[model samples]
Target: MSTRGNPWAVYRRLLSYARPHLGVYLLGVLGMMLYAATEAGLAGLVKFFARGTFLKHDPTVLWLIPVAVVGLFLLRGLGDFTSNYFPGWVGRRVIKQLRQEVFSHYLRLPTSFLDGQQSGHLLSKLTYNTEMVSAAATNASVSLIRDSLSVIVLLVYLFYLNWRLAFFCIAAAPPIGWLMQVANRSFRRYSTRIQNSMGDITRVAKEAIDAHRLIKIFNAEEHQSERFERVNEANRASNMKLVFASALSNPVVQLITSFALAGVLYVSERQVFAHRLPIDVFFGFFAAAMMVPPHLRRLVNISGPLQQGIAAGESVFEILDQAPENRGGGLPIERARGEIEFRNVCFDYAGGKGPVLQDLSFRVQAGETVAIVGRSGSGKTTLASLLPRFYDVSGGAVLLDGHDVREYRLEDLRAQVSLVSQEVVLFNDTIRNNIAFNAAGKTDAEILEAARAANVIEFVAQQPLGLASPLADRGQNLSGGQRQRISIARALLKDSPVLILDEATAALDNESERRVQQELALLMRGRTTLVIAHRLSTVENADRIIVLDRGRIVETGTHQQLLAADGLYAALHGMQFNA
Candidate 1:
């Protein structure tokens, strides 16, 4: 859905975050009430001052006025503290809770959802949009409540001083309210557009940063700059629309209030001069009427942030409402024997972009090693992905240990498999932690043993920090071989019954590949392994190799048998050797 959701509903839902801290929120409301009363009381004091000095002629009135002024301001300061501190406290809490929930939900969302979203846009919602929500929930909300109450109290005081004049002063209310309604609609529309444009800006900037190497190599600086400028300009233009509305609203409301004030002053003067109104009452009504303008101005100004916040809330709630990844059935497995079968499987990505795999059937008995060889786009990776249920088959079923993979709990199913892909993902963390990632109850000795098996200890031991050394982001601090070995170490630590290696040695040089292959051989021992390889040499020792063309497996047999048959496998091996 678009971010321009119903403002009232968005705001109401946003307020619900404060429900857990209602006691503090109510205390803030009480503080605002106390502050509002003091403002009205200050207006009333004007009448008392006039009467005590000019009418009553009492000497003690001088001391009473100064003392009361001090007392009033002192109480007002306390009220201000309570109102600012408590609501701000609740607002910060709301921001934290909302941020946490959105981030956690992101982790559970389907792979399809993640693939369709730009990471930058998600980050913007987490950081920038959430800040906007807090501004509306706290600052705008508090100003709205406090200033509105102040306006009401001041109007009541004016009515008490002179009912007829007060009635004339509020005659412009309906028209001003109507004008504010128009401004609010404009505010919300522009605010939604501004937020979306901000996301675009973030998306472009992040892409440029992440792909800096590509842009530089391709001499595309000007291209990236142009793209950034487009989104940046759009963001600025959207903000200007909100600015124009907000700027115009305040002046118009002020003009309307001025007209009402002029009428009040004209009527009050004539009444007092004609001896129909008391002098003190006339002054008190004037003081109370004057207080309304500042409060009105605040109420007008707050609408911009309030509406922007509502728009932000709409964006945040959209993600929160999304269906999470399907976690499959109730059956759970601590471990599986890892006999895997793909039964007449067919698969397609979203939008029905034709089948990537069709009528593909294969099985690997427990503790067997099978290599899948194919040209690019031959569905090799897609077939392996099915084992972990990254994308379910469009038809047919995948089974693990004679049980449909769909009938096993997603977590339990994934726990039985380890994947090592060409792109090794390592967090910016210590080598030890990366190897032991979330593998609960693994002793340091076990961790070290896995590192040794994966050949990670050889390089790690040469460093002063050993396994404690921290890697840079995506393991940029290490060579491709080192990163690959660290990934293998992770898989070794997992020690699952099944493993899938998709060009795991593709990036390494020959020497490093040889070293890593030795470790991979150890990792594959006695485990059901599916290896997707482009290099024929890498899979020559497999018990069997399946040759795929397009989405179909054209041949399956031992390497020598496939070569003797002179089919697709022989053609692939010939091409690799010729290259």
Candidate 2:
């Protein structure tokens, strides 16, 4: 599956990314031309020096030769510098653009696109694949164009100088051709394996690092090491195969050049003995002939990096070519009144055997608190996710303020709604930053107020740094309850009109839950809220209680009314209350 696409198709795809950097890339090529002229000029200098002191070497020409040499060297160095620098600069720029585009695409991609994709694989595509494209396209292309032109110009000069001798040089090309073809085939074969192995290596590293605690808790350090060793060994073997194949190129080219040098020496010597060629001309031809084969060899060598660049470029282009999720949309709404209605909504989650939410209908009026209770796999989380349009409903519609969520600008819709789930993700930063994740522009006073509302400020204040106290990655420095509270505080700061709490208090102890729930009530005041609760007691005071069975709404009423009705909600209440 690694090298499935047509090579030509991949090339065409990669060329599209180069369009924007074409000017700088072309300038880089021009620099290479200047550099090529320097090498060619040095050959011309050899012929000049071969001329005798009397008539062939005039004082003026001799004086100008050193100056020309110096000028050529300076120009060549400048050209080489720009050629290397600009392409590298362009490559890094392209990488930045590619990373941003790929990440943004991943974010907007439909859940179905991302369901089975591994984080490490995606990371490899972003980092490894992107770098490869830059190296192959920018660096490799510049080298090919420059050296290739040098070869062409040098060959034309050689043929002009002596046609018979040039034929001998051209004769050496067959063996060189065979060698390059062999190397090319070998490299292409091993390179694909190497690339695939790289992806596997990255995946293992990401998984092992992410689950470090789990590995430690299970006393499976040796097991993790074994798994990593297997992946690393596979990667190492693939790399060695590529290196072995790559190692053949230089030796093969060098061998071909050796034979061609012998031919040039033999022909040039005969010409010198027969008095048909001057000593200077013979030496000039000899030197130029030596230069051509190596240049040709290098031109052949460029293909390896070119091939790799193309492969990596194709992967990056694939991501960049992906269409954004909501390209067409209406104007943003200035404000929303928190009226939400799910009108016959239906949705199928990624890789689901069937629809998770089917023909579901419900509504939450302004300033109403609704609690949705359901068994596991009953679409409780799926239903809540649709409100924010994280995954669009497949059928029917989800409306906010009487407009389809899809019709509203995504940012506008999201701004009106805030969610705090059981799984809290915190950045590796200060506690203040975690609380202010959603509202980064909030003042310290605003942050403190939000933390107090979520019942985290009192605890935060005890820390010497208060809001500035640093939190480790994923907030490992804080307890699970503290992390959840920080997330809740973030949601509170948003102060949106619509709030969705999915087991927000699930991880907290009774004391913490009580305090946070008290803050949650104040946060929920004069807002529309949908709470997904496993503990029936927590949502007993909700204005309405809805019991979901499978994908459908089985019953709807106030908690007291449903409890008295002895329905699904009553049964769940009894089960949890007893447990």
Candidate 3:
């Protein structure tokens, strides 16, 4: 999270990704070695030609010059091909692997972790942030190795030809290093801002599109556009700042390099004219000087990706390093009966606030249908969420079949309790796929049966492709009631022993509510059901009605019994629907 630059730290982290592609990486290094040798050979040849330094100087040697030069280029070309192509292939493979793993991790993450995060922000991390690894793997890592080696090989030859001049050229490296430090500091700061702004832009764009109908109805198009533009402009400004910083550093280094080369040339010419050095040595110095600029330029240019790649590396590692949620240990409960118990249960929504459920104790016998009636913010939903261990109760225990829910593996605990909340969620896939979600072995017939049970089969059959008809993103093509029913169908397919129907009929119209309420009643039969209903009529026929007031169970009895008591339940029933 620190905003300081550390390119070497990034490179080391990247080396972990390279383990899978080590063979191709080794090939790239081999290619760079061959290319560097070829470059060194060309420098040696130039020195040989300049002063007839070849031991056996004749017509044959003169004719051989072009042949040797052509062969060097041919080998260098082959090396270049391997170096470029292999790393690109490796980079793509890494992307595919990392994306799959990140997605899988997201699936396993606890629901509490997802509550406050935006879907669009997570999508950007998975898609855009991870894709930066490609540039890091190919252009950044490969270029670093190839160019750094080339510079070293060429410098060795320059030293062999003329040590004094080579030493002078080497002296300029410290100033270049200082400039890179300044550039890297700026790049790191801007790079972090760019990444954060990308998330903001993605969040705003997703909101604008997701609520397009609302925006239009309210005529807020200009407002949404302005919000999006502000975030977009911020992202653009951050990226451009990094660009200008890099541009400033590279050119300044090049200018200094140009002046240094001129000084080296003047000194070498005087030494050669006075016979203090051989003419071939002087030409060799010039050849080596030419190699320094391009090689040094590449070395300097590495900063751009080096900074960005390191930033990406830190982000990726942060996720990969996270410890998974803890699920306590016990023997796996093979058969989960519908019995549930809350013992001295107390929970706070944000960990330290006053308990939403204080000294809450409750028990639901197997095959019982319990309707919980409460006003909004009375902690009805929070109490129900504890059964699935969404947020672990800060005080006591939520037990299933005499065992703590946390004692069971998260998968097993959730598999036993299916919930259909008022806020319905559906993926952008075929209706059949949405119904069969995470139910890997389910068949089309079974999926259809569940849909029919939820009273959604007839509507799906009307679609052009039947069950195969694609639902638009987030099931936006479907009506609110339709989306809610589809969710019920999904939960029905899950076939959990305990069903939690949380205000499933709250937002439906009279017609849809009538049809859906009938289906829900049938779905709850013979199953241990905990229903949270805002409409008093929906739960009037329940076997038991528990009225909660300010996190305490104010009354518990049959609906008629609660009405007779004329307590909180009766008060709520009268307030909502005078009876």
Candidate 4:
């Protein structure tokens, strides 16, 4: 369903998430029925009091009335407890299921979709927006259900006493409903703005937290504070607008209800004075009429949360409704032979931009180490990304082992490849777990072996916990060389037949780079490795090198062959070495 569709539609979808806990929800409904029963019971007691105290003048009446009042209140308290408890129980479960589904959807969404969305905004929907939905689903729902029943039952009691007075109050409902409808529209608009402002606040705060070192080094604390202030003020202003609307709505509704009550008083007084109505029946009717206004006020107040929830739920449903990445065909392979080819491949980010790679053709023979050297933005990284199908080519096909890669199951295809990039991503976990991440079947003996090969054992032996030592976030506890080595160990543990090393040694010191290069050479053995690098020296030992410029191969040969030609490669090499 379109998120922009009717809000009632979005509301129904939110209710459906609560369907699995229907048995618990029904218990809450029974509580509401009990609460509604008290409304009629109170009106009946008033009539009995008027008769017993005024006309019967019985000596037994005083004690009996107080006991009946106490009994009625005790039952009401029990009703209140069940009504709040059971629905609250169901509300929490709904939130859990919603968060789980949304987070799972986040994991499966396409990379392209994620690229277009803000992480902070999405996070707000997961946390802030979901909480707003809970208030609407549970608290507001309780008021709507119990109070609506109260109003209906009280109105019925009023009609039983005297139909004319009940009819006059019913006439006032249309205008109150009109005012509520106006308030609902204002509430929805402000609620959507509040959610967006909250996203902006989260975004700014996250950016500052992630870049604390940068901000401190640049002395930009004041700048960041100003940025945060803008979003924070925006959120405050939006909330105030909702407050204004809510404040205005309640009194105006009461004012209209007051007018209805006054008119009923004027009409009923004449009937009582003319002896057309008894004082007891008039007292009972007035008591029931007084009860209806509070229910109407509560009903009006509930519109704000109800609309806020609808807006929040619509945003959440938008994420849940998105199309996940295609899982690809069913063709299965335990291990690929690692023959990769690009057949006149062309690609755009497909985000209203020109193609990044245009009609590019390339091949890597089984177990061959081919290095791609390029200047920045020359599509070297884009070319490497296509092999793993992080993106499908817009105009051509990427093939593996004489079959289109799209014909293979996505998981099975990715299983044959391993990646180690300059920006190493390590979770805050044990050193052993970082290397063994997603390497489901590897034995502990093999993990130690991969660690040793990648030079991670050099540092692990120095630590007290050895492989069990925990790393800081993004492995900040480790040096550049140490972090790169752990990533290499992770890639090495995977043992995939195809490997893409994207400037893996680019960020390290010269001594560290040299040491990592030794590990790289060891890891490259028996695997079809595609090495992307800017430094010409690293690719010199490769069996073949492809020099890329503007998304096309400008030179392809052995390193000496390109140097002898005195072209882009020779010039690039001369600039690095001769300078």
Candidate 5:
């Protein structure tokens, strides 16, 4: 359920993403082995030089020494290059694959999950957190394997030179390893804190950026800055804690190595002075002993990134493991007749926070336009939302054409409905693309027809590029009325049998609203329409008007009938007319 208990399990799961490129990873490992071998070979060469030149005093060895040094370094450079480049290549590929999966998963997540989550934190996980996973997948792994092998190889050579002194040198290993375990726990704790702090930083900054206009109008620059500073400081503090542990770990491990080196040297000097150890043996053993420190330092430094990566991997996997939106229905339909019925339906949000919608029953005949009017929090939007199964009813059922909505395949159920909400959303693309979004294969002529019907052609005719004109983010470049028209055009293109207009024309001015209303009237023909409007004037012409009070249907009748009754409908109509 949580990735806290076993970091290796998380890391192994992350590595599975890289399994497709196994050949590349194996090549990198081979390079690391070669690098370690070369390091050990250099220590052996040191013994050869000491024996040939100092002991035997051979002339041929003099020429051989320089040639051997150049050849050995050349192989070392080759090994280093392979080890660095191939793993780096694999790391970048893994990042791309992981980010794609996470992003795609977000798109299919249950609406309730999206409703409760902050977009900024989700973006941070996709961008920053996935980047950290790369360190664990490739860099930390390479350092771990390469440095560990180097240490092992050096110890083996040292043992060959003098087994007794070699055994003494590694006596510091147990304590150093214990220190690493302590540092590892600290590193993981601080890394998780740092990642969470980064998400907070992203959330605060995104809010400030998106509300820049509000901030300026209210002169809240200092207020926003102070909020940002707090998150920024928290992020910095978390990172520094990790840095402190990583910096401390290296020196402490090195100090332990230094003690071992001193003891080994002290014992070796007496052995050589008493003719118990050969000069060549002393030089080879000392060379290998010196080699241990750098390898030890690398092993110690790697724990920081490895733990950070594991933390990142855990966060990424958590999202991937979330249950996707339920798509479980065997029944399929090409299209619904647009008849809708809510039978004693009840609903609540994820946490079982008291019911947002109480027992309610209603029916809308096919090809009928029904208007639902209620004050804010009367569950009008929630009621419309259920038709397309955004959130399932907690009790009872929502049926379409005599069958439970859940019985229809999720895609088929959604395809039968089209929604235009108060909050219009448009991408940074051409007006034509926005209208035809997810409905590819629409010819230019078909797109033009939808745009014309929505009155979008009136505005596009004035732009230099017409329908091809690009919009700024969320269509910021367009006026409110223009953006609304684009959304209406999208719904028009969908041409679903069941249409939901949730304050669709709320953004339009009087003149634009009249024009768009004519287009909506044309689009609503032959479709079962559910209109949710705060402005009673907009719904006066519905075939039937249903007045809701706190999620219950209080009254229902035609406009004239409802007015004559002098109830909630009449009161709402009176308030709007007076305003």
Candidate 6:
């Protein structure tokens, strides 16, 4: 939904987050009322000062006026303090609540949804957009409520003093409102552009930072800098449009106010000379009239933040509105028998792309090893991704232990499979913690065993802290093989019935590959293992091999059988050794 079409709709939703702090919010409103009343009180005090001190010149009135002035100021100070402090308290609470909800929603968003989004844009929404929402929901609201009340109270005072002059002051109201409406439209439009521009800026900056090594190697520093400047300049330009709208609005509104004020002063002067208006009464009326314009101006100026916030709220709510990843069916299982089947599977990505895998069917028996070999676009990884339910097939079923994989609860189903791919992921934690990542209840002995089996103990022993030693970001301190072994250790600790090794040692050197291969063989024991490898020699011992070409399985047999048949598998095998 477009927030611009129904701004109050977005604004009201934003305000709901502040409901938990309603008591504090009410206190702030009350303070605003007190502050507003004091403005009228100040005008009243002017009349009292003029009448008693100038006209009567009484000694008692002189003494009381000074005390009244001090008392009035003290109340104003208290009111200002209450209004400022209490709303700030509520705003912070709203921010905390909103941030948490957005963060939680991010975790549940479908993988497909995440695939289509940039990390920088998501991060911007978490930090920057949430702040804008708080400002719109609470900070802008404070100004709108406080300034409106101040204008109302001061106008009522003017009417009480003299009905004619008060009516004249409101003559500017209609045109001012129209002008503000126009400015508000401009603000919201540009605000949305500014938000998108900020996301672009974040996207560029993050890309440059993460790929600094790539940038340096390619001598592309100038290219990245230019990309950043483009986004940065766009953000500034969008902001300037908002600034131009805000800047033009106040002065034009003030000019309209000035004309009305001129009219009031012209009429009041004539009435005073005619003896219809008293000097003290005129002072009070004029004082109240003068106060209305500033408050009115602020009421118009508040549209900037108010509309900007609405735009921000729309961005945040869009994420919250997305459907989460599908929850699997009610079947429960502690473990699977490791039998798997893909019955007539057909799958494709979004945007009407042709199928990545089509009419593909396969099976692996319990404790048997199968390998899938293919060219770059032959759907090898895609086949493995489907087994984990990363993407549901367009037309087929993936069965485990004679039931559709979807019949088991997602957590229960995922618990039965482990994967170690070429792109090994490690956190900035100790070696022991990395191995025991998802094995929360495992004892220390189990963790140690997994680490030792995966060859992690060899290099870890060089560190002073051994298994407890902290790694750098993404385990950058470790060699390629070290990172791969940690991943293998994690998979080992899991010890699930099904294992997928997606080129697990593809990035390692000859020595690293040999050492890792030994551990992988140990990992493969008594499990339904599916290996996707580019290197044909790695899968030579598999019970069976499936060769894919253009989303179809063109050949399937044991290594020797495929070699005897001399088809796609034999050709691919020849090409690899030839290289």
lDDT of 4 by residue, 1-579 (tens): 676657899889999999989999999989988988888888888888887888789777799888988898788888889999999999999888999999999999988899899999999999999998998999989999999999988988888888988889998989998998998898999999999999999989988998989999999999999999999999999999999999998899999999999899999998888999887788888888888988899899998899988899999999999999889899998898999898999888966468788887888899999999988888988888887888888988999898899999999999899999999999989999999998879999999999999999999999999999999777888999999999999999999999999999999989999999999999999999999999878899888999888887888899989989889998889889977
Model 6 stretches astray by more than 4 angstroms: 1-5
- Model 6 lDDT at residue 360: 93
lDDT of 6 by residue, 53-128 (tens): 7777778876788898899889899888888889889888888888999999998787768889999999999888
Name the regions of candidate 1 deviating beyond 4 angstroms.
1-4
Compared with the true structure, model 5 gives a TM-score of 0.98
Query: Which ranges in model 3 have alpha carbons more than 4 Å from their true place?
Result: 1-10, 52-63, 351-353
RMSD of each: 1.7, 3.2, 2.6, 1.4, 1.3, 1.6
Residue-level lDDT for 47 in candidate 5: 88
For candidate 4, give the lDDT of residue 236: 98
Ten contiguous residues with the weakest lDDT in model 6:
1-10
lDDT-better candidate, 2 vs 6: 6
Residue 367 Cα positional deviation in candidate 3, in Å, after optimal superposition: 0.9
Q: What stretches of model 2 exceed 4 Å from their correct place?
A: 1-23, 53-75, 172-192, 438-443
Clashes of each: 0, 0, 0, 0, 0, 0
Task: Please give the CA lDDT of all the candidate structures.
Answer: 0.90, 0.80, 0.81, 0.90, 0.90, 0.89
Candidate number with greatest TM-score: 5
Model 5 lDDT per residue over 343-382, tens place: 9999888885588888989899999999999898898999
Tens-place lDDT per residue, model 3, 71-110, is 8899999889888888888888887787787787777666
- As for TM-score, the candidate ahead, 3 or 4, is 4
Comparing candidate 1 with candidate 5, which one achieves the higher TM-score? 5
TM-score on alpha carbons, each prediction: 0.97, 0.90, 0.94, 0.97, 0.98, 0.97
What does candidate 4 score on TM? 0.97
lDDT measured at residue 543 in model 1 versus the true structure, 0 to 100: 86
Worst 10 residues of 1 by lDDT: 1-10
